[model samples]
Target chain A: MSVLALSVILAFVTPQAGSTPAPTAQSRQAGDAREMTLTLPHALRKGETAWLLVTVGMIGHNQIQLTTQSGKDLGNISPFGIRSGQAAGTYTIPVPAEALSGRRLVLRLSVPQAGGLHRATTTEEVTSVRLVIQRFGNGN
Target chain B: MSIYFETTRRDFLKTSLATAGTAALSRHLALAQAPAKYRRYSVTSQQGQKALVSYAKAIQAMLNLPADHPQNWFRNAFVHLMDCPHGNWWFYVWHRGYLGYFEQTIRTMSGDPNFAMPYWDWSDLAQIPDSMFNDVLTPVASAYERYTKDLQTFTAFIQPSLKNYWGKLSPAQIQQLNIRGYKTFDDMWNDVSGWTPTPMTGHLSHPGHFNPENTAFAPTPIARYLTLQNPQLSDSVKKNVSKGTVYSGLEPTNFATTYYQHIPIANPIKIGFNSSTTASHNTAPSKGTVFSTLEGLPHNSTHNYIGGGAGEGSPIPNGPWGNMTNNLSPVDPIFFLHHSNMDRLWDVWTRKQQALNLPYLPNSQQLPSYEKEPFLFYVDGNGKQVGPSIAKEYISMSRFGYDYEPGYGEEIIGKRNLVLAAKHPTASVEGLMKGNAATLTLSAAAIKTHLDSDTATSLFALVTVPRPTENSPNREFDVLVGAPADATNITADSPYYAGKVAFFCGMMHMSGMTDEATFIVPLPKRKEAFANLSAAAGNVAVTIRAVPSGGGASVLRAVTVQSL
Candidate 1:
């Protein structure tokens, strides 16, 4: 850090090949998220538990970053990991107790794939799969 | 969607000519013409004859109303439950047997082999514009018109008696009574189409308990009395009258528990709520069949309603089918008829509906889109398996199979406590050949499984899967099970149980993939033993099977003890 700062002050810094531009505040604001889709098992019963998985990706590289948006927080997401070529990974999620079975819900997956160096982002809304929970017990 | 073929006149004439060559023309024609009437012994007697006549007239009058009119729909549904000309009074007997007796009378009189009544298929009206209740260019329009007029006439005839019961009522009160409907015969006489069944006596008063003959609440025996006094009939008709009331076979709890109970009742056969005082009677009390019948437990925590062994239904230990007092339906008199047919079929198939021949998860394990205890009505035959050619064969009996009664075909009750089967064959040479020849037929096992630990004491059957070799393709299969023959002596075999309780295993797998076969098992008539035994100490078997499609299927076996 000291050498880079001193070099900048001395005007000795030079741009290197394959160096991408950092995102500006304005670019980050303009490049919003697009194309969101959530996937899950088709059904779950009331009072039953199930795992919910989420994924987010961007259209182009080096222009956008994706993140989770707003909704009722059921459970926390898994630790993030990096994909070498595909730029995709998995995350485990939880289904809430009050969440009804046999119904669909939309979860916003932000702009695009995270870690897209210098990429602009856009968003899209896609319907998620439905979940249905069943009843239980004897002598009903 | 059915395949059709053309036939030649030459073939038909040739067959007729061949037949004529074998016998004289007159003899052949006479042979084809008909034979003498076949008369069976009659069960009706002098004491019940008058009541039977009155009941018939009441039913006919009730039937002569618009299908959508609340009263007409209610009465029709009631009659349907009591006298469905289908698989006898199976559902009625299972849900309410009193209605079964009434249905038997109707069956006896009509001489219909099967209890099939005409149904107003609403799908026909679904395509028409304006209202589903009416159609512009069909016979249905005329039917509806006649129904409306008959309802109005009946209402006018019954209005005065209702007024006399609660004398000099205010305009607002009278309007409320008319709007909501009538309860007593007098109230109905004053306003036939708008009477409600109230708890206490009104103008059509009679000194009889509601639960006569230990059946459902009696309607105060007003119909017979009125018919006897009518001046329209001849002396011979009056002389042939009978007087005792037959049970109406209404299970008050089944419909009341579903969305139907919310519908307002007007001269209902069974009074749902106590309408005598100003207090609201809709709130169920702490104890009694209304709420206590459910074992005071959550639906999910309680035993599977259609699953498990015996002694379940309504009215607690009495079982819903055995008790005649439960309200079956309010919007339809055919409710009794429909149930009766359902029960009769039950008598035929017994445990076929709860077989393990289909795909299911073992020990109450539920599949996606379903929970452990969630149940579905197949609409097909009581869990019997069939092939594509005969897929549409199991139509509602009331609509077709017009002459269905004793000895229509043959009744095959599967061996008691033996596993019934519906096997899925492989799609290879052998499987294809089996599928081509596999028609809908029921068979039985000779040996019965005893109620002992080593015997497994569990229900089992085979499920059919097509193309089991296919890679993760969606497959379909059917469940098969063994049931008691119609002549089974349940009391002799199972001394402690009173009625049947059907139990079904969850989805099972065939080969590598999941199969969707469904089956139900019923408890034989020995409920007392079940009550006396400790549930925690007993070991129960929970079987799951998975059958693949397009021929050969694999099987998975699992069992568990009673967690309770």
Candidate 2:
């Protein structure tokens, strides 16, 4: 094998902490839903705003929700009502002044199945995402 | 049959300069014989600023009139013309017709027969002109109030609610109260939000809402944040402003040289070919190649950078520019100026292509039903309202009596030395696995030298995915340039987060076909990262992996990166 090819192979084999796993063909297949991992800031103080930037493969009629660990809804993503696909945008999520007591937050992304029924229910969806957010003291 | 009209350049000039009498008639006749000679000026120049102010005044006057009145007709035209054929083969041709009619309306209203529209050359100036922000002309607050009263009277006849709305205010009360009038042409153009006096809704003769307070009938939040020279913005915002203000995908130095200079005239692969034989009506080849590297890169990048959302944590965080969006863009006057520059670029590209004896596409191909579609109406030279005419009628600007100022291209291509070290060899890798990374090598010394000299030196990767069928689900891919180990961890916040590729329905469903959907990622600043790579690896390697967007499998056609 060439030096370049060797480097590529070795780069794959040598694993490091927090490294993103290479997506296989099966992971990217249509209808084979996969969980999307977003890299958000570790913690937000009370009354602080964090801009969550998500890159979705398809942005159809979907909704991304942010809430507490026990499922108290913070808010639905704004600039919503997406009609097309392959979209990217920033959503501003704010931690209220009262939420300083919480230690953790969760972001849930719900995308309805393409042609399947049960469009209203979020629990039984084919592709769903949950990202945990760590919290810190209110600085201000 | 092709409508053949020929006139000498001198006659065209005379026709453009002649006033609205018998001389204007003769000039109009001359116009039919050949292309007219109206020079489009840059907005930064003295003449260009003057022309823009004049246009604002004329549009303001039009705004004051009733929606159906002759003066207001031009302002009303934008509502119907937008969100149709942008980002496709017809983008240039349709706008040419749209702007041509608008210029005629301006001449009729302003009475400056020689008046031509000025273009905002963002690629050259890299910022919205200061004149666009500062008040250059005296405020016409009283005149605006008078027009608003006139509009109130006009609309009250159709909608009684407007009569009730206006009954509360007297002329004396109106004069005492500060009614918002345009302080600058930018003030008039920047309001894209919605007009004051709340547009009329129920039982109006016109189909759309009318804004009596502002011309263009739409309100825009004076994009005060758009000025690149403003010092109050944070360093990060300033950086975003600077990068977003200019084309980041290609080096200004080698763009015109390596790409445009090397383009062959007759090569259908570079510039699109005409499949139809109809004289004077060339159709874009249904399958042939189009768009040279330079044109395609700057064109799409400018659209996305400008219209796409402002950076996260920006002063106007996530606020999108109207110029970036398709449907509401025409409402912003900058839309015209930006498009005029785009048209100017097309003109330059055509000239360079023709110099090499390029075979022009038969009538410019348009989206379905738009080939011969009429786009609004405007008052002609004889004071007669004309058009609702097809785009074919306005194909050539000269045919309509205007041309860009001489040497506009050369002026933009002014002395800039090409960084030979910045140029990277074109490399392609097959089977670029989704989420799996592969690296392409580049000369580290070249990257360091380019960055050491120009802090704005950016790395751009052109990711080409095989063209998908019309029904393919939308897919997006993220590209990064750095150490192979760090490739997977690079989020949108990471400096290595170049940008993403979005394959939407509108792009895939467009009439003309592209061999591949080429996405240009303006890689974030990574000079130090590049330096580290150069010290250790002797070369910079760019890694690209498909971010799992759950669409069709992405088949890599080619991937090339260069320092710009």
Candidate 3:
């Protein structure tokens, strides 16, 4: 390989040294009711706000509903606030401490279509997810 | 489309110097343009990636300079540290000057004369470009380990030298620092330390009475909050940087805000893109603190998310954060890239003003004080201080001799002049949510001037909502006009969609026990959204609803549609 090509390859493949891996999403979907549950290493520390970072390849406008196993609703995460966009990529949904039942979070992912809308996600697509927690209040 | 109008931002300041006439506003006038010397590109672009290598080299060179050297990486950050503005109008122009000089420094150091800083369009990408993590570009690189291993280590390494440099400030520079509440070195250090003397006892050494923690310096590598693996902005930050919100920021014609408008207490209209026109950038406005939507929303939220301050990457409630979160934010390599995008947005906004033939700076009466606010601390790329400079000098991008490679909001520059609509009197809301019967009374001209997308005029609805209790299920509500009374769970695609009004009052008033909060929701200018309103014959009644973004009971108070 050329030196430039090798450098580019290494840049993509290499991971940072001494970095800890965050927990990933475990997906469970019935015919149409799609869901993903994430377990945190620890319960969100006191004074912390958090989000469920979901990487999905969405075809059209879509949103995710963040809630707990016990059905305590956090909120629906929508791109563009009141609006919806395809927003296909690694996107975050607020997973506040109140929604987490002892380090466990269940997300109800949906791509609610308007009349005649179809195929929010294609078959051949890759997805990933993680939980991010911050003790900072964001000056709340 | 030509970005430069014949006049400059300085001309807006000194309207007495030239005819402030509508001749500049004529749609047919031909404008002569000069190409900019540098062009900033998006980090996602290949050219931007190439520029990163040069940028990294410049960072490496700056990092190796002596502690007191003006161009030293840490010393360079101090220029921002000593003279940055927040919550006011100087916010945009100040950053433009800071980034412009730094870009020049990078050009000289990187040996790439064409090198302009590549911007991270987080509004689009939502992640710090993956390449930002490589080598000297990331703050955690080995090059920074010595100066920022920990607070004590960092202080010990740089304090004495910093103090010596502080002692040598020229009278004018010292005067500016004094105006910023930094009369002494310790006074300046207090901001860095987040220190507060006990109010009751007036004692400095009161333990537990002190702030939760001093944001003294950068955290240790082990405590490094953010990483390459988790560079994506959290969803909350993305909420502000969305295409809809960014364009809303650019929609305002005025650069600096009018004083008595769209603040917490008043229903005064005229919302501008940047904040209040204040005497000094370092201080709060004499009227009231107002941050332009762009500054308050996307600008701040992005900074916090990257610094792990916004519910990401486990940042502590207070104390040492990644250099991006604090006054020393310039210490982060990503700061330049992040700010370059901000400067570009200002350019985009300026170009749109040129297209609209609108004044892009404070009016002439407000000019002298606005421009005279001294910026004395900046050191040029050549190691000499930028002596006796003022805010007006940094008003235009041409001052730095750079332009932006067209990014997200540049489409506004090509927007043809919106047709003018005849002036109309004030309009008011007639009814509330009564089985889809909520109505707004409007003058006939309101349809073309306010509701129609074809006109330059804008009309905003001042939405009033009762302060939600801590137990309120959702703190955000979506505003819709002419929606069915029963309409629920509608998205942006709905024709009834106006905009969302969030109860970010505690985020606004710091805290509120108040009865209500009012949000200014600019009615969507899309003609299709108001198709029904134009068709109404008798009493022009428009249905309005404030449904929660989340599924819950609506706590919307009152909404008033009026024009100034």
Candidate 4:
């Protein structure tokens, strides 16, 4: 399955309305790669820890790069311990201190191929996800 | 009654002294009041443009002098004086003093004692004045030739100087650059980069640095990118086009009618000078409260729009105007004019507040520690470099021998009737998933009446949320105005699409000061959408959808749909 196809599936399964998040999944296909989407809470509080439940679709090494809209690289998530085609362990992605400056942070996922002819040569493309961190304890 | 009216001789003498003392105090106050020698005129007017041209010429002459000269000091002082007091309580007072000093310097240099700085009223006339864009006042033939020569000389100095500075980069920075395969300073500088240079401090000595013509005032990196891509055009053409893009990107028409109209009179005064108990100061307003509407909406919008892309206008970033970012904005000549108008708006808002018997901080009492707060150091009238002055001394514009054009505030106040449309009850949203939306239904009749009554009719979506903590990440929400069904996937250019409700938390939010944040977006005037609603629905619905760019819990507490 490609990343584009995975994205469509993820959009369909996700809850359409309301602020609360339910366990949801999406997938999209891009070329020969398959990408699965994980839902994050719509809003985050400052200094709060956020977890991403990665569902492994392909057997490869995956990393996540977070950036701003102006393309300022924030930080990266790496060293995933997940097997192909299975639900993976929850990964802890610490929000950086500077990341709390009221600007949207975009997360881009990359899956590097391994052990094949193209081993260590290319990474699977994944759609970027956005995260907004709100001020803590501020009632909406 | 006659017995009561008769006073004892001792009592009469005491009363006479008291009356004489009162008269003397009044006379002293009158004497202390400086004459308004200079009148600030609109940049759009002929007299205004002429005065600006004359002032620019005087500045150019002063720029031609040696670096150590006092006349040259005035030009360099602007760069230094502007580094502090932005995105804080000191934003207005600091600039007010800076402008006052600059005006005096210009007057002295030009030998035109009556010359006052002209203001660019972007809120009213959304376009850059023709004078600034064209060579109407300062003929280009001579100035352009001089500017080209000066630019070459400055570039020669800067390029080699940067190479030296590049060698001095921290070992970590040098290693990172080396890892990126940057072999030389020129190679690093030439790289197509997103990295912004750390702001420079101290005085700039070159004539090119003083002349606006020698430098392109593109504030955003994208504008610079576009200019680099289109190098075939003359520098003048590129500058003009850049200015045009900045003007268009500001979305002036939508701004004046929507965001500008929605700002309550008290907001301009309260945001910077709000008392400790007011909504925008130390304590945040209750959830869903609409406060600091001016500061959070039109004021921030203009800054973001002009400085870069993050507010209304084209969703893309435009080029640089020094007015875009708070720190280096004063370097651009337009900064003074833009700020002059802002100062005027504050005055206008204060006048309106006075009329309504609303409480406000007087100029002298604008900041709590105003009297003791050291602003910036600059050269005084005596040609002596003065130590930092306190905020209280710079509060009154008249004290500096200048005043804005008479009745400037009245003109702005008169436009309020168009903004006085019926506001719908506030709708609260705790959070929203991407593609999900919250809608507020307003009376179609009220909207129609407002549209029919005014040619500048525009719908406004006012979103108010509790102020985010100082370091909280910025969040943005897209608002769509129209019937509910047609509002999906609306582009910024669409009449149904209102602008983004953005929370730029960093400098704007001081730590421990919990103020409410409000965002007002002017919806595009989609006559068809209004017509469709009028044809079928009793109520018009405005929907705010969360864009995928910002993922977090919703900060939105209340949204109001207003017409202007």
Candidate 5:
């Protein structure tokens, strides 16, 4: 948030606010999200906890939101126990059993600088994303 | 932007001398006499090891600077702490600018006219160069023990100056912080303190807010998580930086498109070489932005592994860890070498895109806001403030007058790896809805295209989920398709597992905005997922369901399947 980064490939001069072109097209429909589908393994037993390991680039704080395909709005996923984003990018998002109950599911996640209020118009990306099932109650 | 004028204000002289042939000569002669670019060599080379000696000298000088000085080693790390972006398109360009200027500082301080930063090229040399473990090259050395002896000493030495710097920030920087969700200086400081007011004083709390004690203010010698005794990366980390993974890191053709990967994989997995794009370099993860495989893979994993944050990029101990794990990473000498590799990978990816005759960067039209985004915080070799520079200035290594010594993936140069355009990519159908499950009936033609080895069109489920609200109780949810009833949570290993959707909680619910949000999710491409469809069939029935991540109700508005 402290810096603004743009890839001006064709021009070197910084454009004045009004003179800058509108985004030509969005990769997706609404926001800046570019998604590549990944496979999800591991199953959670009742009341079990799982870790959503996401490799982030540099933003300090991130937020991840989840929802069921039935459109169940789960609030921001809590950090696995006390471990949140310790590094510049590695985040531990704990997914509890209540959220993984159904035979099938759909979720909407956002690991934000802090996802709230302003529409996310900034440029950002994530690297590796996966869920680690916590069979024991120790590591969050 | 012709820096040609930088040579001299000889406009009149050039104009008078420029005959038709002279004009051509001006172009070709300048071309033939290309200036010598600084060469960043691999650490394994003698030249690179020599550069490390100078790098050590420069780092020591920066460390010796007064705490109040902008070029002080800690304050330089502050530049990264304050401005670096991860998980976004600017990830590459921002770092390029950071490194370019830092390299200049090294040149100036080390007194080496030909000095260029040496890169670790982790794929080639998996262990840290033994030279880095010696003297000032390691953060654990005696030189760093002075300022970073402990939190009390560090806080006493650095806080006052940092606060003064914060007080001096321009209004524009403050405004950017506002959009980035830091409303006040206290908000930013709270992240350092890891103390969030229960009620929301500026909403500064983040991922590990649940921790009673979360702070990044400790950077002692002990804070160096990896010692010379354990300098090797874990086996998993070695895999992350393996040659094949680096190739995948260079695979995405588009500079940026979707949050994760907007386009289908070139080879079932080969999309998103670069990270996704978003609004601000520091913007939160939204529908528009997700992690590119490279940043999410090698870069982050490497940081965590060295810092021992996650013990090789998985769940490890919740760490005070090392400086490498936190925003204060540059405190460790290894940080520079690690970033050099990251920057090198970006260079390789850029050249690969250029060789394929594809756009290596986002055209202005793709992200209009890009050009206006100024990188405001950087210190130059003379210890002078170097920005408000924009991203374009650092988009190419040429901007910094440097080039990398040949390493892995440089082979893409002059090689013609053809990429096939999507053919009949527009075939799609609607998915019939059931409880959390959608039955998408596909035609034989749709199945064939999806199954095509050469021109496989990626299938995505445009799932409609609720928009993020500060009041929302649920933050994360898992998605699974055709899994058994007992199989609820899933990871990448499971074929029936779809993906996980997460939200940043803690924002006020927007009023009058659309309540429903649509996400373009790529369908899993595992052959096992479509085994039944091998025979040409009229249609297939697949059940996609949403698992409540945190105890919450299901509310899927609709699911549309499309191939692109």
Candidate 6:
């Protein structure tokens, strides 16, 4: 049994099988989550105004909305009476350069927790950041 | 890849010039021997010669500022967007404005007092020498021969505009921009020109324009390391930057929604052993590299591997990462100062002085219920819980405060689970119920309460069942409490509970008996909360469980009958 102990017993009896594993905690724990897209920051221009950090910290007792698929309500991040054992803070919101054009949008974030017993959503796919509209004296 | 960028560009130019000569010999060696609470300065101890005089006084104060001073177009579009791609956020705001212009030119050469910048060891480039990337006073071996003579001015201006906007790519996206995108040369000269912020020391100098018949060929040694340090980022125009990869930094399971993933503000009581689940080593495939056992890789432990390639089984510069803009990992911006010193040691083991480092049980793997648990961690998908075990989630570590002191070994010791206890030699555990003899209570009688919580609360012993237990198949129960004295305080009145203690037991491996027996116990100690009142007298012991007998100890109706 040598050849480096039969390649460490066939590298612990080989098993690449269908591959794609490694991510568990019961597969990223439930209702499944993993999505990212954040383009907004060219000093954010157009209507020229920026500031929208918004961070609702795992808000669970419900309340955490944000829209714009023409549904517009791009606001409300309450996170209720702070400190229910904190973790979510930082809300700046103000952005309005024609509410930053589009190329695929959706920020949604609702959360309903215990008092309501269930209701969780966390969408975020914001691609809108084109900006090069300068014009003025044509400093190009 | 040129020996992993000649050991990460010669240990990031010799650990940013030996942490700018250990922040100038830790200012005449004092802070009583440099480990924490440090803040000194005075620079001349010449190592990387004050990181080349703090990179020529932060490129002569961002080339003398003015041109519409919004920090001179964010220091001229962050040093011409340090030629894009290294995992975006404008490569972490151009590496927090080039490490805030090398921590303000090392606090204007030490005259500033709050020093502490030191890191770049890049695992001692697995033991140095390759003429440490042909020296040239290191900016990664002069940006690795200026990224191999800016690959013939990026094949004559970003290969005919990235083959006319992304049409000819695969060779794994040009070897993912040469090993995990934006493999530097000031990010492939910001993708062959176009990221355009042309200025030479500040104001707005201009050297811009390109195509002199593709810059009259013949320059190489990476076009003399990009015209000797950015001759206004030329080499012809075409743009599209954003080069961050090696899986692009910070994602230790979102680690409490990223607000400082592993706190190390100056080693505030350090300890970062996430050891990425059980460690081990020796996989080495050599030069295609892959050396496993730092727990078989994936940002190898407590995070940071970014945009990939340790190829042949991988593991090279793998740690102290930062680039592609999650800044901090240019060989250790104390890798975000050792995860903010292991998030302030789980905020000092859950928090103290006012109390509640709670948790004495329930971390469920649910077997024959062999308890000793505590240490939970969830973040989104609605299960909220964020922190509840590092002993009961914070109330003070002097309130997120940070002076950070303690011989810098980055301390970390907390995780023990190995159970079994049974003490009835005399502490008390007599029985014979229904026929009369009730003494099953508890608030704290002997095992002086200290299993620390984040969620599992129980302390039982009660009796009364006229008739149950199908003729006993297993019921060995014993988990009593009370022996207090070393500085006693069971409160609700304590005379060692007047008589009958039995503080530990569990042998009930499942049987179907009768009459009555309830023991869900398993507390042998160390989930921790000791404020040391003369080490709180926790003498007696017990933890045996074999239950299944007599109507399955219906959680012994949560005990509390008193009277001896």
Highest TM-score model number: 3
Please, what are the lDDT tens digits per residue for candidate 5 over residues B1-564? 000000111332243233323333433543474664799888889998999999888888888889899888888888876777766778778888888888888888889979988888888777777888889888778888788887667777888998898888888777766766668776756655566655334655533242323455556655565666767765555655666556544544556533212222211111244555577887754433445556765676567556654422223244555666666777777888788888888877665554444566665575456655778888888888875778777776788888778787764442222111222236456768767566777665565665552212257565666655656555445555556546644654466645555444334455744565554455655545554676746766666665556544455556667665
DockQ of each: 0.01, 0.03, 0.02, 0.03, 0.04, 0.02
- Where does candidate 2 stray beyond 4 Å? A1-140, B1-36, B77-84, B134-331, B362-384, B406-564
TM of each candidate vs. truth: 0.23, 0.40, 0.57, 0.40, 0.55, 0.26
Which docking class does model 6 fall in? incorrect
| Clash count per candidate | 180, 19, 0, 39, 87, 86
Q: Give every collision pair in model 3.
A: none
Better of 4 and 5 by DockQ: 5
Instruction: Give the Cα error of residue B485 in candidate 3, in Å.
Output: 17
* Chain A TM-score (model 6): 0.23
Cα lDDT, model 3, residue A125: 24
Off by over 4 Å in 3: A1-140, B1-32, B195-216, B220-224, B259-266, B284-287, B310-315, B414-564
What's the residue-level lDDT of B20 in candidate 1? Answer: 36
Off by over 4 Å in 6: A1-140, B1-177, B183-339, B343-403, B406-415, B418-452, B455-471, B475-564
Who wins the DockQ comparison?
5
Question: How well does model 6 score by local distance difference test?
Answer: 0.25
lDDT tens digits by residue: candidate 4, B336-454: 67677766655554443333223334333333554455544445544444454676687667668666674333422222122222122223222222334456655776667645632
Task: Compose the digit string of candidate 2's lDDT tens values, residues A1-140.
Answer: 00010001001111212444322111121222222223222222211222222222232223333433334333332221121222322221323212222222233333323232112213222122212221211100
Tally clashing residue pairs in candidate 2: 19
lDDT of 3 by residue, B1-564 (tens): 000111222332254223223323432342457778888889999999999999999999998887878898888888887888876778888898898888889888889999998998877798778898898888888888887776667677677888998888889778778877778997777655555544436554554233323353565462235578877776545656766557656765555644322222211223466765666787622224545657756776566556545232334433344566656778888888888888888888776666555666666667677787788777787877888899889988889888878888864553432111112224445445454234576654665665443223356565666556665546667677766556677665455666655554443334424556665555655555454555666446565677777765445566666553
Index of the highest-lDDT prediction = 3
Query: TM-scores for chain A, candidates in order?
Result: 0.32, 0.37, 0.56, 0.35, 0.42, 0.23
lDDT of 1 by residue, A12-102 (tens): 0121123332111111233333323332233232112232322222111111112323333232111111111122211212233222212
Cα misplacement distance, residue B508 of candidate 6 (Å): 14
B172-216: candidate 6 lDDT, tens digit per residue: 334434533344443434433324334445545576433211111
Fnat by candidate, in order: 0.00, 0.00, 0.00, 0.00, 0.00, 0.00
lDDT of 1 by residue, B190-230 (tens): 22222233333564664432222112111211111111122
